[model samples]
Target: MRKHETYAQQPHIRIITGACPHDCPDTCAWQIAVDERTGRAVDIWGHPDHPITRGRLCGKVERYLDRVYHPERLTRPLKRVGPKGSGQFVPVSWDEAIADIAARLQQIIAEYGAEAVLPYSYAGTMGLLQGEGMASRFFNRMGASRLARTICATAGFEGLTYTLGAALATDTEAFAKARFILIWGSNTLTSNMHLWPFVQEARANGARVIVIDPARTRTARAADEWIAINPGTDGVLALAMMHVIIRDALYDADYVARATVGFDRLVARVRDWTPERAETITGVPAARIERLAHEYATTRPAAIRINYGLQRHAGGGMTVRTIACLPALVGAWRDEGGGLQLSTSGAFRFNRNVLERPDLLQGREPRTINMIRLGDALSLDPARLAQAHYRPRPVDPPVRPEEAGPPVKALIVYNSNPAAVAPHQQAVLEGLRREDLFTVVLEHFQTDTADYADYILPATTQAEHWDIVKPYGHYYLMLNRPAIAPLGESLPNSEIFRRLAQAMGYTEACFTQSDEEILREFVEAQTDPVFEGITWERLVRDGWARLNLPQPFVPFADGRFPTPSGKCELYSERMAEDGYDPLPTWTPPATRRNADAATVWQQGWLFCISPPAHSFLNTTFVNVERLRRREGEPSLWIHPDDAAARGIREGALVRVWNERGEVHLRAHLTEDIVHGTVLAPSIWWNKLSPDGRNINQVTPAEESDMGGGARFYDVLVRVEPLAVASEEPESTQQAVSLA
Candidate 1:
């Protein structure tokens, strides 16, 4: 797919069309070009008639015109001239930053209400029509607070809508029609990289793969076998490979009796989870879980994929409802690339109340919040943000922060950063050092949550605006129009929520629609039969479409599954009527291994933290300077027997830490992870680390088990070396001191 010709060698060099709104799982498409002789954006790639981006583009959008002509993008709006986390600032005027963020969100909803206003976001520009569509209908017409958006695959798509009533996937070209793949806790070569060239063309037509993962990734260096396993014991290796596929009978008994129902209570709940109790909770051995459950119950079509870092731990939703009942006990949905992916993104029905209008949430219960407790809702306490009351279960009867009600006092933060990917990190930097929090941050860079903004604004780049995408790993339906226009005074997050709903006067018709008429009324409010006959003039003349899925789709191959008895729910009275575990097992949380690596290694705590970066995604391009000169610094890996049980050495520099924050890296000994685990991977921003903090500063607002998700592989930590490569970074009582 390499063909290029510059007919634009004439008329002002044009090109255009877009998609990669990067919170990736291949929403690729691409195009760009634009040159009016350096009025900028000269070339980005992929899109040669994309179908799951066949025309190639990763390694961060093939350096997408070096992060959209990076001269540090964020063109205007700044404000905060120094002090809060201090990157400092100044410049302004987008009508003076939308009339001072709509008069400090109408004076925090007239003094501490509208849940004291909070917004924060995710997928950092995942662009479903301006990511978090019109900032969730301008904070649900400003009652401003409900954000649970379960940080990444809510416990594996609520364990595939409690056992395959949904969570589809198996067609992004059916993993090249698999013979046996698996890959599990993903790193599909640095995250869904076009499903690793169709699983390397199904391993060059023979297929096999394997992987599992407790690290050793780059797709377990292109696996035929990797298996490391241990962090939150992947549902003890999928209940010891479904107890060796129901003890060697090799399952699929007449497709588990014509498509599942509690197949003998999931075979008496895998008898006693054998394979020597999943090789002592997945350090992986019982003879490789009975020879990979007899080659995944006698291979045939078999597949697996499964990611979202194994639900991000605390036995992540019973390890994704016990690995989605192992492809319905090996019937593997009767073929095509067998079953188990983890997010077909609920088969795209995007009307989303035409992007979160929620009919103006006038029924407004608004108070939800959970984005991993944005550091306890920005250090709550303006009398708990004028308490209206909240504790129904926030950690089962653990409510006390004076029963938190409000205290955000207007935050907005589009497409997230939360002090470099949240979760405890010095209590989200002391709740972003809350001097009566007002923040704002739209961002493009100045991120570290726009250095604790008091307004940072200036967004743009998805090659400067217009969006409409869909990709929890490919099904297509793309379009991202604007290739240039708003690069300075940069707009489009639905025109910055249509200039903050016209500086908060909001005479709403969905705040004056237009962005191709709200993407043609969000594609004529799609009524999902995978968008039958999909049109917005056939997505503006085929810029990208693909949803009608059929050929080799094999959707549960005729067992009829959208649940409530139209099959496949291997034991689930809707998961014991929603308190979970009608069958999905692996209980695991008495604080998993209760992290006592011997008084947490005599109290420096080190067990592990930070992980998404086989060249960065979670801190997207960790400030790309050509992917930080091809990701050099950020080190840690560990295991030369935990770097000689932590006197650490190979390249030395250490620190790590625990009671919730501390950074410093370097170590790299590696058995490719698993020996009291240690990795780190890249996180950057703390002024590109040397430890002013990154890796969610010792990561721990904990959560996950059923999807409040944010465990960074249940971080444990305790590293240590620095006898002085000019040591520093530790203080916050030596990072949560124990002695």
Candidate 2:
């Protein structure tokens, strides 16, 4: 393909193709119209030729220009001049900042060992190059403490792997052919907007869409039927469904016998999980549960869309594992759009080994720290923190310093805002406020995490960088080209890490490689057949390319799964070896089951869940004035019965408190949420909120049963009116949910 401007016959306007770098599953291929004269982006739109995005941008990405051109965007390196969390800073040149940062890092390494330095990051930017290409090399060379990076969907990933062999799923585009769809624990309209179109097409074809969640989210309301269940009781519901399917002889017996293992053991395990028994545990009616199971088994081409929200609890992994077994029993994999969709990430086998360059470690194995335990990893005593590893559960008992290594004395933060998103907000804030901890943040703005940094280096946005993005929900690999010049003194995250490596006097030739050169090497290193014709040059020419997969791909149609047994593991021996139940079982939420008198002293304690808001993707887009105004102030959604029981009326200021901490939020009474449960759509920045806190204050830094993921939804709190007037007028006539 030639330059787009030449084809359009426009000399002043040049169009460049790029990919959305935010932490989203829909890696939309986008085009930016830049004014050549002023070097400014004039317009942006989705790639019309892309199959998944289909020339449509999400509500958030549609206004991405506001973020790139925001007046408060960081453009230079700054040194903190006041106490931590004060947001006080003075400008510094890049050379001075790099030299000072390198010196401090070296001193820390010499005094406290390289393991004392920690690098913390997450999927704030999903770009392969900008996210961790160069950063991983720098950290590996330094022998710094390794971050487990398990803050998000690791529990679900592990569950899928143990059950289905990998994080494989039904194709997103095939959802249109389904006759029955179950959108479980996912708000498709908000989080995964692109897949919603296929779901709607299925609906148009007379498919019945049922949603099973505690709150009536937008997707649920749009669904044909919304069946509310108790939070963290998904495993129980799934087991009961299996019970009904097996007991009623509705399952595909031939398919199950040939395609799955441990059928005999699974039968005995789910025998006692009757709908009546599960009704007591899940708060869903027995008849409805039985009907759901019947419909699911009887309906040919049934599809399920489960997200990571359900796996943010003690039983999260088991919940996903149990649900992943349903498709095999019903023989859903035999047809297109008939299986479950948890994640399609396993399909894109990128050459991360070459790109990240772990060989730079030189045989040194540094202490590992879990990102979910960032507060403890940073603030706890060295000997008390224990030896961290990538396990399904937290390490028990403490290990000595000789085993666990030293405390984190230096921190590097990029791509994520841990201060706002991490659980146990107070502890994270405390850790960030430590005077002895040296922190460096590379960001586009002074985020909640950046305010506590010893040095803040400006990072470029997606419009001004080169990157390759892989989608977790689809099968396309996108290439991002620079649409406009870097604003002010801002640079790409890859460049920043490259310069840091140079300042450290590291003599590695890989550190001098350009972004495009690194990208080409990354592309060439791919050995998977999925990359057959997907070359770096092709990506540069076409902007995006689909994986070389079969059209309407049905992966397990022949009963040949990718598991060790060559079939679906209904009962995983690996799980049994790891001290987990081999067959699917429900493990109640730890916080709820072990609520002591001290934590649950009051009778009005409500199960609280803090899902992301529609306008904000974690902490991103919160600084945008339009999105923030649309989100309004941080508010809690409560049932009218629960709110009235505590004298909490609509729009009244209320306090949601637990043993960890308390957060003040306005109460919006609605039937959208179930009784005895409160919903707070969040990840709001502390500085912008009314009480300098968010929902994470009440969320514990607890790990789930698998993949050591954060239990963000496993929280119990008491809600009470704060004796303040409503901030604005309330209208009883309006709908009370996120309609």
Worst 10 residues of 2 by lDDT: 730-739
Clashes of 1: 10
lDDT of 1 by residue, 447-497 (tens): 777888888888777777777878888777788888777777877678888
Provide the overall lDDT of each model, using Cα atoms, as 2-decimal numbers.
0.75, 0.87
RMSD of 1: 23.8
Task: Give the TM-score comparing model 1 with the true structure, all chains together.
Answer: 0.34
Candidate with maximal TM-score: 2
Every model's TM-score: 0.34, 0.95
Residue 645 of candidate 2: its Cα lDDT?
Answer: 79
Candidate 2 residue spans exceeding 4 A from truth: 1-10, 387-390, 393-402, 595-602, 724-739
Candidate 2 versus truth, CA RMSD in Å, comes to: 4.9
What tens-digit string does per-residue lDDT give for candidate 2 at 430-465? 899999999999998999999999999999999999
